[model samples]
Target: MKPGRNMRLAGLMRKEYLQVLRDPSSIAIAFVLPVVLLLIFGYGVSLDATNIRIALVIEQPDNIARNFAGSFDQSPYFAPRSFSSIQEAETALRRAEVDGIVWLRSDFGSGYLQNTSPPIGLIVNGVDANTARLVEGYVQGIWFTWLEQQMELAGKKMTSPVQLEQRIWYNPAVRSTDFLIPGILAVIMTLIGALLTALVIAREWERGTMEALLVTRISAPEILLGKLIPYFFLGMGGLGLSLVMAQFLFHVPMRGSLWLLLASSALFLWVALGMGFFISTVFRSQFVAALVAMVSTFLPAFILSGFIFDIRSMPVIIQGLTYLIAARYYVTILQTLFLVGDVWSVVWPNAATLALMGFFFHGVVYHKTKKNLQ
Candidate 1:
């Protein structure tokens, strides 16, 4: 730990950088991975549960039963299939073909609408808490809202008339796919790729491969970049998976330009990859690297990235910190791209922020890595 040891370490570190640059796997991951991740993230990771399968069982084909079933069909969330009896609907629900089942008894037409106990019952699978809540909320909002409006339309003079005209702005259809696809991209990509990089790199260090390369003739930046290349591609692969799921599987519309989406992703991944690499350099142990990456990237990307919650609603200091998080800008550009379309005015600012932040992290990583690797 004296001057001689420090100088000798610095000399060896320069050589390690060169060997890493020559590694092909690293280069492909760095250059091409970002675009793939944007695609996956844009399409794969969606919050909105679409076409949730529902079986509607009605004993009698009354106007009211038909009307009630009609309302559910009009909703994007429910793909309502009619059945003659409750047993049929229950079978579908149990067999996992349907997420929920609605049963309408023979007397649903007259008795149910007259403030009597509902002849219709909604039975849902409670295994996935999030999907279950979404199904329940959709049924409540869509079916009950229609019922409330019907009562008012009948000209009944009732006290405390509730006039709930709920309008969803930005995403007019209230589609979860629009919001969730972009948000989950920030989360899943980070988890599957960015978070993985630090551990993988730290493992190399712990196992002495990094030291073997250190005796060669590469520069510090080359070594850092080399480490980043493979992980960067891995992250993009995750992104590609998500995009296929979002656009093809879920059928969410692509309103924005794909070019813009790729552009934003490039900048965001740069920052994320840099952050992960820097973490690996700092924490040589795989365990600590994993923990730091999870705490630093995964949790924030999921929660504070505006994936699950609104950043504006958070405390002022927290909101300020979100600016430093790569996921924040990624969320912004991706959301605007997905929901608002190719809005350059809306997208550019976030893109610029990501570029700037990426550079900042790049500088931090270069400095830390050069010292640590040396």
Candidate 2:
């Protein structure tokens, strides 16, 4: 407001920047942490299951059975290991050597031309039900495809009640990393913005610098702004590093306008910073502030934000609780920006929510911050 307050704010920001430069941990948090996280999560984690080991048991080894078995070998999803008997395949399954077994009975070739359905058996290990379902689906896909091929070769049409055509949008390749990296970026921003500022006031108090600031003529609003401004840039710096890695290193497509992504990111970062500022002001101990920051911001961002798990798939109560997490909105914005582009329908609502949250948290911080240091 006044020129004197402006001068005080400017000086406070400058002091904060200098303090950050002097603190090696600040630099590490803002830059090194992003690099390390991106590298670890980008390369080390994946949801796709490939090269699944499966057992193939051909009862008669007929030309038809051999041709069908060849399809499993050609598929990228499966690595077929031939088993002479169903007993042997069962043993392999018990040993966890193969995920599934496909058995083509002796009557398979005859049944192909007959009125009866072919005698094909599929046995899948149910220890991991998800993987078992995937394996069973893969087996059915191969079966239907082979049946269609046989019908086509014999100049007979296969009858179907309905035909289905699938269209996969956003990520057609279905690489889980493409879906995961943007959400990880949102989590990273929460850590950078919240964790960095969470220690600011507490550290100042621990060092007796807060008393020195309290003695000054600077207002509470000015003090909070001064404390936030520098770390805001530092968090943005971390966001930039994460974006670069996502683009060049991970090759995650950025379909949205860069400006829109940055604008939404800025709003979200402000919300995250406000959360940290509130935590720092409430708890005067640096250790306590850091712990609270991680528990309140980081945990919510990681779990409730739908970073890895689908929020809708969560329990109804847990899904309702997610509305309180700022990162949930930011994660939606990040996924929309990175995968679906500048879809205002998605971005506008979430960005508005973030803006509202930012104002609310900062308002509380300003109200709670007193020059007397109570």
Count of clashing residue pairs in every prediction = 23, 0
For model 1, how does the per-residue alpha-carbon lDDT over 1-374 read when each residue is reduced to its tens digit?
Answer: 56754554555444344544665544444334444545565556566788999888888888878887889888877888988888878888888999998887788887866768665688999989889998888888887667766778887644456765677767887766667767776766666556666766887899998777666655566566555655555566656666777787656667888877776776677778777777887888988998999899888887888886888889999999887778887887788888778888878788888778778777887767553345
* Candidate 2 similarity to native, TM-score: 0.93
**TM-score for each predicted model, relative to the true structure:** 0.61, 0.93
Candidate 2 has an lDDT of: 0.90
User: Which whole-number lDDT from 0 to 100 does residue 56 have in model 2?
Assistant: 97
RMSD of 2: 1.9
Judged by lDDT, which candidate is best?
2
Per-candidate local distance difference test: 0.73, 0.90
Candidate 1: how large is its RMSD?
7.8
- List ranges where model 1 is wrong by over 4 Å: 1-170, 371-374
Per-residue accuracy of model 2 over 254-301 as CA lDDT, tens digit each: 999999999888899999999988898888899999999999999999
